[model samples]
Target: MEYVFTLKYQLADEDRDHEQIVERLFEAGCDDATVGMGQPGRIALAFTRDAADAWSAIHSALQDARKAMPSARLVEAGPDFVGLTDVADLAGVTRQNMRKLMLAHASRFPLPVHEGSSSVWHLSDVLIWLSGRGSYPISAGLVDIAKATKQVNLAKEARQIEPRFNRQLVPLLA
Candidate 1:
């Protein structure tokens, strides 16, 4: 099984070389990792690993990153959830097509774990649904990466939203 996590780090300098830092993290065994600029002076790292060793993998990667950039401070880290975009990518369909399929086959679709502007499902649930459809050539590894990417984007968006507005939003799925 694969598990995904997103890590945000604060950079001491806003102008720090992000690509170089990400490359170093990659070299440290974060094979499925991607980095992006977060709020000013911050960087976001999203990665996936086997469920059996996710904690070890994340710990080692973060340690390596901290060693490489002494000023990098971990801000937040958590499990990455899958959204419609991830399912669309895994199924080789457009987001519109994915949404349409979900709506048309609502009873057959897995209930999302979270629902807001974009509903989010567990990666395993999406994969099982895709397998049942039997129309898409889906790979678990690819889906894991896509899920992590989607989660990272969601986290960024959440950070950008007003706290009051966000507080009023309730997830459809517990």
Candidate 2:
């Protein structure tokens, strides 16, 4: 099983190079970490780890990142989930084909955690099913990395949409 955490931080100043900070974080043992520039003076970091050791992995990564770069200040961090598009991409199939397979073999395929316009599932469940399918030319390591990347991207999209809608004013919003 794999777990993903998306973290946001504020850069100390313009002189603080974002790429350099990312490099340092990676060197500090964040092997599955990806970093991107967010708003001005802010950056986002995504980290992935096996579920069995996620708590320790994240704690260690945070400690190492802080030690390596004192100027970086953590803002928020949380887990992220993946959806059908992510599964299709990871399995090297079109979304339509993936959905077809799922529908045809509903007994074998795991049900999604959230079933709406875009169904969501835990990365581990998707990877486990994909690993058993001979059509997918993917390894365990690749699945872990891909799952992390997908979760991070999904979380970013959700964050981008949240600000545009007001929960009180839009009661029927999906």
Candidate 3:
């Protein structure tokens, strides 16, 4: 299977040289990705990799990226965070219809990860919610990728939380 994803990293100051970064990435089995160096001190790799599963593709990409820049920190792995329009488009429904579904099933709809002017959600959460409702045209591969991305992003975020705080907070959240 070919999985498409983006991995963004915050480069260490010493590793910000574009030419060396690009060559290192390519040599580290990242020839499958197109490296983007837009924001200063940041790099984004948009990859279309062939692997047995989305997880494998993403995992290997992360390893390759790490190999290229050992000091780089992961910023995000995406197609995980999105809004109603994104979910609607993937599910083959209009945004209005998606809004209607959310409004109609306020009690059951997946909660947005962010709630404000424009909400955001973990793509897998919304997809799973729709899948439970009925037959939807959402692709299994997309859902798989969404799930993998969500996990990657969440794990990245988790590493930042202080262990003592996480230990205390875990039981409370549960």
Name the best candidate (by lDDT): 3
Residue-level lDDT tens digits of model 3 in 13-53: 99968999999999999999999998999999999999999
**Local distance difference test, candidate 2:** 0.68
Ranking by lDDT: 3, 1, 2
Q: Which ten residues in a row are the worst by lDDT in model 2?
A: 144-153
Clashes of 2: 0
Candidate 2 global TM-score: 0.51
Tens digit of per-residue lDDT, candidate 1, span 1-174: 666667778888743876787777777666676777867788877766665444455556667667666777666564445688877886789999999999999999988878889787776567767878887887665455445444544565677778776667655324
TM-score of 3: 0.94
For residue 107, model 2's alpha carbon misses the true position, in angstroms, by 3.1
Hey, what RMSD does candidate 2 come out at? 7.7
Taken over the whole model, the C-alpha lDDT of each candidate is 0.69, 0.68, 0.93
Name the regions of candidate 3 deviating beyond 4 angstroms: none
Deviation of model 1 at 86, angstroms: 4.0
Residue 42 displacement in candidate 2 (angstroms): 6.0
